[model samples]
Target: MRHLFLNGPVQNGPFTFATRPGKAVGIRLAAALNAILGLPPTPHLWNTVTLAGDLRHREADGPTIPRQRFEADLITDKYPPGQFPVGGIMTDTDAEVARLALEMIENNLCAGTLTISRETVPSCRACGHMTGTGSHPCNACGSTDTEDRTGLHLVAELAKDRPVLDRSDIHASHRQQPRHLQNTAGNVAERLILSRTRDHGIDLSPHGLDGLVLDPRVGIHVTVLAAARRHEADTAVMTITENAANHIAAHGQHFREHGGARLQYALHGYLPYDHTASLQPLHEAYRATQAIKESFETWFLPLFSLRTKTATSPEQLPALFKHYMRAHLAQPAEVNAAAFNAVQHAVGAGNVSWITNKQGLANVMAARRAPIPSAAGPAHG
Candidate 1:
């Protein structure tokens, strides 16, 4: 199958990638794997259809900017000057994503997997925002008073024949499957309300569910599929955290596949960016150059996260760096065609074992260097 790795849509919160490097793990992981597979860069996906976004826009002091422009500007700020992604950016509420989401929703509604019905939910008494089922004050207006409000909502009926998130929904080898995520993702109610009160989102008004938007959880799925569709990929592998996958999997049940394209989560772990400074001594010892340091931080670290599917502890940094330096040092004088092909095949087949194997990593690194022979000079480290 033709596959492409895409980051799980990131929330457009107020944070720069420089300060919060952890947030870019998914994006970096997807980019690394896609590069290994020889796929062109894919647009970085962002989830701008968030309540936080709405609140931020509302509270901004100035002549009002369009919500779309406001989100675009915020996303652009995440990257450093002149360092935006080469593949460009795509927000969850982009026109193409909205179109795809509505199409999927319609198909689900027709197939009895989704329905539009009146739902009674808690609402902030002061601001008329949906407060969900919590005792805390409203997130939008910080009001303590809430009331049970009834309104039209788009609902999804979880598939009766299968779990919300099964093995097929994940992009991992059988032995590496995430059982905990599967169990927890299936723990939600049988019926899920898929519409929300948002000032900006994939508007459900097109389907007669006026004043509501597609749930961001589900919209994120469509965003991935929409990006895959653009590239004509049959399978879109989304790099996401296990916790995030569990939170959104249930809502994305009926939205994972469309037009012969399927979406699957590739669960990854957090990196210890805070402890990366610990590698300073190693950098000195290895005489690492800026390129080598960047390659380790942006490429190898993310790929490593796939192997260690939980947080990579601060203590593990030294060992991980040593392993990386070993691979860097062992990078073959020339690409091994057979080994390179094997690594590509393994990447396509969702086998991450090669990442931890020194020889395999060397061969893959050789392959990465092959395209630009002039740039394949010995690593200064």
Candidate 2:
């Protein structure tokens, strides 16, 4: 058994917790998950409108919160560098309270406290000007102490459960033909007709397209997973690609081999088949898109094995989710030409602007450049 110890000032000093129950879950607990699945040391996601009545989510399911005991002896004693008596030298101690406190700390860790380590120190950055015989200058920065900055802090590490992808074209180029076809020109063309009818909920017969090629960038869709860590509010995005899909499969296998639970999984992409107009052609195309998307998910699943240990692979995930687990995967609503034109009109020229329909890739990327409309709010596009 191995242990990780982080320093912090959260009442308890050093503590230990178990990752596994009596039996190993087969897969080793992800270190990143351990780092995040707990109460945050700072208030970034959950907010408090008032003190005492603080509004923050606490750890209900974390490693430290588990009620199991592991077989081991963890001892913390301050002793001189010499041989000492084994059982007769303790001058003062409270073993029962100490044991209870350790148990509580373990419980909290199991409940996702995410609290690794902490410590309290004087406000050295602001304490630079106080002058007196007994008064001491800031230990960090030499100045008279004026104010105190005291609070709990954590030394944290992050773990991720996302599939990695290689941005290089070569990696994508080697994926199964179906996946590549679905991502490239073929799926793009299929999506244009699907979006027009499916998104508007209308018929597609009136607008004739005997000969047309849809644009890939404007039509192809991908699902993204989003999750957050303790103390962090920014949602991390994970765009599932061929490589990522395969990685998940491989990871599952690795878990099974290592005395872990076996996962019979499927990468299910949500299909959008809703349409307002009762056009036959539109309905046919909408149905076809949904079928194709489902087929793609089935086709992509059997191409890989689970990974036993961490190793280098050729994969690329978006920048925001390069290092964490808990991501989301969803197909965003399409942005049409008229909507694009409207966004341009509203933002005006000279100043740069982007267009997206709150739920697609464009909108996700556009969110970084400007204040994209909230899901419940209206926008020019």
Candidate 3:
């Protein structure tokens, strides 16, 4: 396949899709695009490596359960009963992802782009957790006692000749390039430490950094690539918010491409899910069906977020719903091969214009109604 859309691994936090639908925007957007392209549903990716996760695990059951099982259970709980993802779920700490990450790190080290060297960092004396900067107790153990400890770390030297994030790193059209994100992401220290003290993650001990794990920011990229590799896609388009992209772009500089698959971020805006209740009146007015309601909430809104690239206003819901209804009504009885092909091409090119075009939207709606080979199997988690 030419391209596959994947979510920038959603953090495995304590929340359900019903309570926080906004968190699933990336997953919904990717699924919509993949369905449009007639590609099999790709696995929903998750980021299980986090300081918060470590503390939660430590506090619950006192490490009686395996960390991987704990994370998987949390991820499973996010979806409603019997409503898991169609293609399954992949976490950042998946064995395949960890292997691919180590391979990439080794390659970067060999090229002199990354090095394992001694560096001093703040550490919690009681818990041995990296305290990071500023004045604060350790997040893991809530210990005020900390010390500067020198240890081997995986370090990446920022490329002197290039901005940390450029147009090529983004999957949007030239006109929609995230210049602001590029500038801000570039404004970072010349060097970055890519290893962290995490209880559960892609362990760097195999690479000589004992007790350290590959930074989650970088592991997220590898997770996407690993998913793409499973599907043999050349381009892995990750749907992420501009803010999250800025936070992780620098660390993912060298991790974006590996083994012939290149990764790119498709920046999206936050949706006002809290205000979606306001749509109830419109739903009643339109006498919307269950499928129509889902299409509006999960598909159309997420796609619109890409075009907005900022928080989508709740005020726009009525008009957006009207637009979706119009498109749904205009869907041709017979699929338009030419129009459908054009829409697929646009999707692969990261073009959001098609999403707002009446004819293009109609064509997509028609395609969604038609049966495709990839849609034959039962949806998975």
Kindly list the per-residue Cα lDDT of model 3 for residues 1-381, writing each as its tens digit.
499999999999989999999999999999988888888999999999999998899889758999999999999999999999889999999999999999999999999999999999999999788888988998888889999999899999999999998888899889889788889999999999999999999999889988999999999999999999999999999999999998999999999989889999998999988997798988998899998998889989998889886788988888888999989889877667777778888888888899889889997887776753123332222
Candidate 1 vs candidate 3: which has greater lDDT?
3
What does candidate 1's lDDT look like per residue over 313-358, in tens digits? 9998888888988998998887666667677788888889998889
Model 3 stretches with alpha carbons more than 4 Å out? 372-381
**Candidate 2, 1-381: lDDT as tens digits:** 111111110111123212111011111111111222222222111101111111111122332332111001111121223422232211101232123223433443465432433223334346221122345774334566445433333211121332212222111112222243223312111101111101111111222311111111111110001012111222211112233334332211111111111112111121111221223443363453554332222211111111111121223211112111111133234323344344333222211122112332243323323444434453455
- Model 3 scores a C-alpha lDDT of 0.90
C-alpha TM-score for every candidate: 0.96, 0.16, 0.96
- CA lDDT of every candidate: 0.89, 0.22, 0.90
Clashes of each: 0, 60, 4
Which runs of model 1 end up more than 4 angstroms from their true locations? 372-381
What TM-score, to 2 decimals, does candidate 1 have?
0.96
